[model samples]
Target: MKFLPIFLDSKAGPILLIGAGDPVRARLRLLLAAGARVRWHATDGDFAVAGLDAVAASRIERLETNPGAADLGAIVAVFCAGAGEIGVTVAARARASGLPVNVMDDPAHSSFIVPAIVDRGDVVVAVGTGGASPVVARRVRERIEALLPARIGDLAALIGRWRKAVHARIPDMPLRRRFWERVVDGPIGASVLAGRSDEAEDSLQAIADPSAYAGASAPGTVEGRVTLVGAGPGDPDLLTIKALRALQDADIVFYDELVSPEILDRARRDAVRIPVGRRVGKPGIGQDAINRLLIDAAKSGQRAVRLKGGDPFIFGRGGEEIEALREAGVACSVIPGITAGLGAAAESELPLTFRHEALRVTFLTAHKARDASSVDWSALTDRKMTVVVYMGTTAANAIRDGLLAAGRSPETPVGVFARATRPDAKSVVGTLDHLPALVREIDGGPAILVIGDVVSHSAPWRNASPTPLFHTFQMAAE
Candidate 1:
């Protein structure tokens, strides 16, 4: 909004430098480094300035007079420094010649201003405060410099080298973008950042020509990988950046019933989506069918993504899928997300593990394991431990009975966070005895049950605020 930022073609022609001062010398170094030819124009016989040694000085062409249209036509931009009245006249001439002109220490009379630059070779970042505050811009540039790895530019250059080859190999734009994304965000990019150019080049070569480099890890070969991604609770905002990348890079995505539509929308538009089962009793597509689909997709050299709600490794049955993929010789990885319980706890302002309050947290799936009585309910009766139950709405009665039978008091405070972190999310606070009643109120759409003393102390369950948003946390009487 302040100033239109553009990278001029320095190689097109020479950049005219008017006057010989400290500013002029600094601009010369930048121009030379950017591969710009410079024509030095000065009235003084001694055209020397500080910092420029014999080598850089000899490269500059000395111009006797102020540059006319012919000279301006041969140059990309003009930099004037400490010329006083003569400098103003030179700036006017450069502007009349239709060349972008910069007058040092005066932005009002200039068409362009030199920015505080963070130069990382091929990757250059320019920060300008519209000539308002150079110090502020320089400070911001320093922060960015610290954030970016020293070898990031090298990584970029490496990718640039393979750009043509990648385009030739992958004709499709979407697939090409995905390939590059994997290269930059995946293991290849990591290798480059860590100064492992050799490994990065090898990986890049393998991707470019799978047939020539058939190592097991070679990406686009007959062998493919399955990335298990957690979509987080119902809110797309809660999804991790890594999870989003996995979806965008996926050739096919197998999602759970609890996975929200918004999260699925983030995946590549052309990606094939298969709905796998996660609903309480609704038997959608079985797990065996899902496993076969993933294995088949990978074996055919297509990247597969298994999108689950909350943390996949939590109650999402990710271990089972991992085991199946491993058995079929398919390479796989997991990208963890904010689980339903954690997201719910945050939204409700409930601390799962508070000092001197709740010392430990436990996550348990309400859906009984193959052996119905396998769960050690007694172990979960610790007063200091907070218990979060996933998919527990349907098994509310069963959960209450088990906890009560395990000698846990019926007066134990419990909170139900339904559709946690979503805009339309709701929560209920009540005693263990009221668990089944609270379950009845919920529509059974991805809920997490939190039990412990912490539940009563949370913002949502305590004194409800007058705002409609807080009304969702409907409290039941003792």
Candidate 2:
């Protein structure tokens, strides 16, 4: 909010420079590299930086100490560095002459501050903290540098060359926008990134004329992409960066019941939201219906996102969705998220795997237990193996019986976390025998069951103070 960002057309004319310091030399190099004619006015003669000779001969000019008002008239901008009292005077004169002035380290005197720039030719990014913190701004620029590809600027230049032609081909504003997006984000962009500029140009032109290149490169027809994104364990923070991008890019998001509202709120504001939430005992749309919807949307060239809570592959019916997409010839990808068990571990500060205690961890869903009688409950009874059950609140009694019948001890420590990582999250600490009775108390909220010796190390157990559970999963008034 402190500074409004604007990219100047520096190549318009010569830029005025007043100083003899090292910083001034660096600024000269940048100005010259950007193809700006820099007219330097310094008390001392030496105007040498690392790559001074690399710049063209006529690009730079060394002038006498004091520049006249006529000299400032020819310059587009002025930068003063380490001129001491002379710097202040020059700043005043530059302002009076109605030119944008930048006095190094003096925000008050300067009309503009040069930001830490990530110069990718046409794809330039500038990070500025309004001269408040240059170091912080530089650090932010570094992070941006990592996220952007090296050839991104080249890719942009490739698109720039075809801009006028594309405009002529697709005149409608919305259609033109869609055409550019598809070309830039699809095969043409990929070709540019891979150093195939010729191929990229061909792709771009092909996209512009779909009828001619319909079979070879149908860039006009963008395929619908389905991303199965995980909305991690009720915490928006736990969502992966890739998942966030998918949400933001989604044209239509088909989310489930377990996904939190906060996570859904991160999606593009104008994106269509369709709730296909399916919970036990709830009258809801089936998986088949959801698959059909996803296929239909994708076929219509819409970017569809199937947003689910936690890791999509882990008992989330994500495989089923992938299979359905494969059968329907729609492209689908998965973005992983922190499941409830891992989220509960962080929230409770309990290690899922301890060296001497629980060494292995297993995640299961009682609701989707295909063969309950044939389930390997006996192997799960091992004390060293921590078992996490999702959607088991409704079948807690059956789970309790199954484990107990498999010779698992009734006194085994069990922890139930409801709405894990959420502000109104609740927990119940008890033994395996207490699970059946405890399940009757918990109501509509999504809950996870962690049954292991590791539960002994959890926060509720360590604190030894639990909100007593009342009938119907309601807490008695304190």
Best TM-score among the predictions, by candidate number:
2
Clashes of 1: 0
- Runs with alpha carbons beyond 4 Å of true place in candidate 1: 1-220, 368-376, 464-478
Assess candidate 1 and give its TM-score to the true structure.
0.58
Give per-residue CA lDDT, model 1, range 1-478, as digits (tens): 5898898888888888876666666777888788777888764544766666676666789777643332566767888876666667778888888889998888977999989999898899999999999999999999999999899899889989988976776665545665676677888899999999999998776654533233334444445689999888878877888888888778889888778788889999899998875566557777888899999999877789999888889977899999999999989999999988998898888999888989999888866533214668999989999998877777788888888999888888888888887776878777887888876666666788898989877877666543212224642311
User: What's the TM-score of each model vs. the native?
Assistant: 0.58, 0.60
lDDT score at residue 59, model 2, on the 0-100 scale: 83
Error (Å) of candidate 2 at residue 362 is 6.1
| Cα displacement (Å) at residue 21, model 2 | 0.5
lDDT at position 252, candidate 2: 92
CA lDDT of each candidate?
Answer: 0.79, 0.79
Write down the worst ten-residue block by lDDT for model 1: 468-477
